[model samples]
Structures are given as C-alpha cells and as structure tokens.
Target: MIESAFPIVEVPDMEAALRFYRDALGATVVYRFPPDGEPLFATLQAGSAQLGLGLAEGATAGEGAGMLLWFYVDDVDATTRALSDAGYLVLEEPSDSEWGERVALVSDPFGTRVRLGQPIAPQPDEE
Candidate 1:
C-alpha cells in the first residue's frame, strides 16, 4: 500500500517555474536547498498537495512522462477558468464525467498536465 507521494517536475528555469506554480497555483515554498543561496531544488505546498521543482540537467519538464498530474480542487469550473484566463493552455474544458467528477485539464508552459477535478455527488438509484 502506498503511504504518500508527491510529484516532481524538472524545470530548465527554476525562477520562472517557481513563479508559475507560486503565483498561478497559489503554492507556497515550504522547503528549499541551500536556504540562503540560489535555489536548485524546492518544495511547494498548496493545501495538502506538494510539488517538487528541481533544476533540470538533461531532461526538460514533463518530458516523456506517461503519467498525468491531477489536482483536486474545490471548484473545477472556476479553477479551470482562472487558469485558462491566466494564459495556460486548456487541453480539456470543464465537463461532467460519468464517474461523478467535474474535471478540466490544462498544461503549463512546460507542458505539464495539471488536471483539476471536483467530486460530484452520485444520483439516487432507480427503484
């Protein structure tokens, strides 16, 4: 059984990526390497979700990844609209799914898929 996990994105530009996650997503820098100097690695916290940003050596952000990062939000529609309005690429518009979720997908400048989802209550069963 998995205990806990956090997604890490390797970025070519640390400062820019930091701003994107921080300002756009409202993540706060919880930890950083070399606390006093240039940040090569850092951890960001937005509610319960934590994202790690590390300086990319050879691999770029979201390069050759088979998994998509999902973020659970309180309001999928509002969050999707806000992110899209801020110039992020919207891969999927907010829509209701058969699985009882309202979901939307957007990509960062580096092509990282950020999926926002809000759970919807199930309908009553037929008699």
Candidate 2:
C-alpha cells in the first residue's frame, strides 16, 4: 500500500538552490537534514506541494531535471517483491537507509527509475 508520493530533485548546490526556489518561487524550507550547518537534503513547500532537494553530483549549469519519484509505501520489501513478480525491473533490492526508512529502487515501464520507501518500524523489545 502506498501512502504518499513526492519528487526528489537533484541539485548541485544546496544554498543556491534554496535561494532560487525561495526567492523566485516563494518556496519555504519545510525540513532539512543535519539539524545544523550544511544540509544534504531539504524539503521545500511551494504553494500546496512539497519538493525535496538533494545534493547530487554532475548537476551542471544550475539546471537539474534528474528527478526521482519517491513513494512512501506501507511495506518497502513487499512492494518491491510484487513489482518484481509483475516483471518490473528491480534495480536495487529493499534495504534500510541511514535516514530511518526502508527503501528500494525499481524501473518503471517507461524505463524511468522510481524509489519506494517506508518508515522503519520499531523493533520488538526482548524479554
């Protein structure tokens, strides 16, 4: 089951990107990584929609169209499994991410890669 979806845009410079989106489009910073100092990722709210910006290499001329469609699912592994069974190309197996989400990558029918992610559930307490 999918909960929500968003696009993660690749950017070369976080500060410059923030300035562009915030000044030109009036996008406000909603969330950012590394509580202090530099951030590797940031989420901005432009009107009613939220957009994610992540630092990526090879982004030139301040234009980045390398966007990844991210889906928040109920179960990352199960979702990837179903997609794989249905003949979709599973690019990466489901794995835990450092940011507290289980994630997987798969290529859509049109060859565009999409990411599936879900919050990691708390572990059961041992007796």
Candidate 3:
C-alpha cells in the first residue's frame, strides 16, 4: 500500500537547488541525510507535500517531460507574490480558468514548472 507520494527533482547542484526551494517556494527543511556536507540529498516541505532534491550526475533542468508537480494553495495571488518576491520566475500570471480555478504557473530555478491553483468561488445557486 502506498502511504504517500512525493516528487524528486534532479538538479545540477544540490546546494543551489536547496536554496531555490527554500527561498523561492518557501519550503522548509524537514529532514536531510548525510548532514555533514553539500551536494547531498535533502527533503523539503511545502504545505502538505514533500519535494526531494538530489545531485544529478549530468542532468540539466527541463530535461524531462510531463508535469513534474502541482501545488494547490488557498490564495493564488498571495502565493504568486511570495514566489516572485523570493526570486522565482513567474511564467504565467494568475488567471481564472474556464475549468473554474484561479491558477498561476511558475518556473523554479531548476526549471521545474509548478502549477499553483486555488478553487474558484462556487457559482451562485443556478435558477
């Protein structure tokens, strides 16, 4: 049985990756192994999700396909602002989607696309 799931991102440099996650995404360092050094594996907490960062031998950002991860927030505007202020690049500004969600797309320093979304206001009772 799968108890939980988390995304692991391969980065060129673990230290820089950790800094980006910590500073840009406001992720907190939960637990880190091999605590004695840099270029090691570390885990971070963003809301209820956990993201792992590891040193990729020779991998580059955006080397893979498909959506890496998505984070759901209560307020898209606030989240976007926070990420922007923290030095992340905002690929797409927050906008209400036709599917009924306020979403903003952001790219992390490591080139991972983070889809931040908040449920739209419930439509008033239909007549």
Candidate 4:
C-alpha cells in the first residue's frame, strides 16, 4: 500500500522555480535543506499535494519533458482564468473532455507543463 507520492521537479534555478511554485501556484514551502543556508532542495505543499524542487544537476539534470503534472481543483475554468491573469502561459484553454472532465494545460515560467482538471458529474442516461 503506497502512502503518498511527491513529484520532484528539477530546475536550472532553484530560487526562481521556488518563486513560481510559491507565488504562481500557491504552494507553501514546508521544508528546506540547509535551513539557514541557500536551499538546493525543498518540499512544498498545496493542500494534500506535495512537490519537491531541486537543482538541475547531477542525477536531476534535464528539463521537465514527457511528463505532465496534473493538479485537480474544484473549478478548472476559474483556475485557468486566474493563472492567465497571473501571466502564466496557457497551453490549452479549459474545455470539457469526453472522459468526463473539465481540464486545461499551462506552463510554468521554466517550461514545466501542468494540467488542471475538475471532474464533471455524470449526466442521466438518455431514454
């Protein structure tokens, strides 16, 4: 039984990435390595979602590719609009999906793509 999963995003600049996660995505830094010194690694929380940010070197070198982080919210449209207002890049506008979800895609300042989704209630069967 898995307890929890934390997605780690490696970035070239840790401070800038931290700012984007904290200010743009509303994530709070829960823990940081070297507490008093510069943070090379840190954990953040937004509600129940936990995320890890680290320097892009050594084992973590490379851009966020072939991975799409999904953040589920109450209102996909509202969140998308808010993100747009904040100057984030909207990769895909909010829209209904055939799989019964309202979803939108956006990219962080560092090119990390994230998908925001809200589950749609199932409709009554047609007679």
Candidate 5:
C-alpha cells in the first residue's frame, strides 16, 4: 500500500526556491532536514499539495532535472502574472483549452517549466 507520494525537485538554491514558492504560492515550510542553519532538503505544503526542494551540490540555476511541473490554481491568469512579475519567464499566455481548462505556461525561478490551469465552467446552452 502506498502511504503518500510527492515530487521532490533538485534546486540550485533552496532559499530562492523557498522564497518564490512561499511568497508566490503561499506554501508553508512543513519540514526541513537540518531544522537549523541552511537545510539541504525542505518540504513545503500549499493546500493539499506538497513539493520538496533538495539543494543541488555544485550545480547552477536551471541545471536540475528537466521536467515540467503542473499545478491547478484557482485563477490561472492571476497566478501566472504573479509568477511572471516575480521574475519567472512567461512561456505562454493564459487561454482556454479544449480540455475545459484555462491554462498557461511559465518558468520557475530555476527555469523549470510550470503549467498552471483552472477548470473553466461550462457555458449555458442557448435556444
């Protein structure tokens, strides 16, 4: 049986990741490896979702594992804009998708691609 599952990403700077995630997404620091000083690994929780950040040794920003992170936000456009204003690169603008979501693409502080979306409410049928 599986107890829990979450994505743990390697980051060039733990503090940078912490600031971005915490400030932008309102994530809270659930735990840290050392609990003091500079931690090598930290886990954050935002809503029901959890993300882990591991300090990458001898690695520069944007050098970690290449993977696209997806998140379901309350407002895709607003969230994307905040991230972009915070210096994250905007890859795509928010638009409605055929899959019933308003989706947008942006890069995190470490240059990792992040996809944010919110389900679009169904429209009423007109006679």
Candidate 6:
C-alpha cells in the first residue's frame, strides 16, 4: 500500500549540513538541485534510505534526542567503526541484544540520532 518514504531534516545552513552528511555519515549525493548553486535542498543516500536536508527561513538548529532513525546494514561493527573514524560521535558502542540484533548508535552534526543494526543468527532450538 505505502509507496516510499524519506526523512527530512531542517537545517540553518544547508551546505554545512550536507558536508556533515556526506563526510561523517558516508552518504553519497544522489540528487542535488540547482547544480553548483547553494543547496537549498539535497538528497543523499545512506545505505538504502534517502535522507533529505533543507534550509528553511529563520530556522535555528536545535539538538534533539529520543528520536532515532534505524538503518539495517550487513555489518554493524564495521559501519560503526567507520563512522567513528570519520569523526562522527559514537553515542553507543556496537553490542548484541537479546532480541537477536547487533546495533550501534551515533549522533550526527545536526543532532540526528542514527541507529545502525544487523540481525544476528538465530539460536538453535532446545530439544
């Protein structure tokens, strides 16, 4: 029924936010409007999801917590380590959960919480 979705973040400075997404999160610029002009809006691909960053009039950047967007990856540890190495703030270390998932959390420059997770192999059933 649902077609598709993407998360949009409002930023005061679109260029700086775009740089943060591209450098820290390892996102590739998929589609950017206005060519070489200052980016008022841009789309970036992080893993499978498309993240949008836009500049709005009189918008002040605020640090927000408790809101998290989760992304599924093949290797949680590797992704986390790479993000950390790229200067991203690692909020949580990679750890396995009882629910059969390995996950890590990080914070972006714009204060967006991102969760990276990978499913773990199921345990054998007891006889």
lDDT of 2 at 26: 52
Report every candidate's CA lDDT. 0.81, 0.70, 0.79, 0.80, 0.82, 0.78
lDDT of 6: 0.78
Q: Give the Cα error of residue 15 in candidate 6, in Å.
A: 3.5
* TM-score of predicted structure 3: 0.79
In candidate 5, the residue pairs with backbone N, CA or C atoms under 3 Å apart (3 or more residues apart, or in different chains) clash, namely none
Residues 60-109 of candidate 1: C-alpha lDDT, one tens digit per residue: 54545665777788898888888888888889999988777899988877
At residue 120, give the lDDT of candidate 3: 84
lDDT per residue (tens digit) for residues 56-109 in model 3: 777566526565568788899998998899788888999988777899988877
- Which candidate tops TM-score? 5
In candidate 4, stretches whose alpha carbon ends up further than 4 angstroms from where it belongs are 1-5, 57-64, 122-127
**What tens-digit string does per-residue lDDT give for candidate 5 at 1-127?**
9998888878888888887777786789999999889999999887788999899965543435568778888999999888888888888999998767899988777777778888888732321
TM-score of each: 0.82, 0.46, 0.79, 0.79, 0.84, 0.75
If ranked by lDDT, best first, what sequence of candidates would result? 5, 1, 4, 3, 6, 2
lDDT of 5 at 32: 97
Looking at model 4, residue 66 earns an lDDT score of: 77
Q: Write candidate 6's Cα lDDT for 1-127 as tens digits.
A: 8788777877777877876778755789888776788878889998777988888775543246446768787899998998888787888999988777898988766667778889877632321
Ten contiguous residues with the weakest lDDT in model 5: 57-66
Relative to the unseen true structure, what is the C-alpha lDDT of residue 78 in candidate 6, on a scale of 0 to 100? 92
Clashing pairs in 4: none
Give per-residue CA lDDT, model 2, range 1-127, as digits (tens): 9899887667777776665455433568999997699989999886577888888775543113364556676788887887777677788999988667799987644344567878775622321
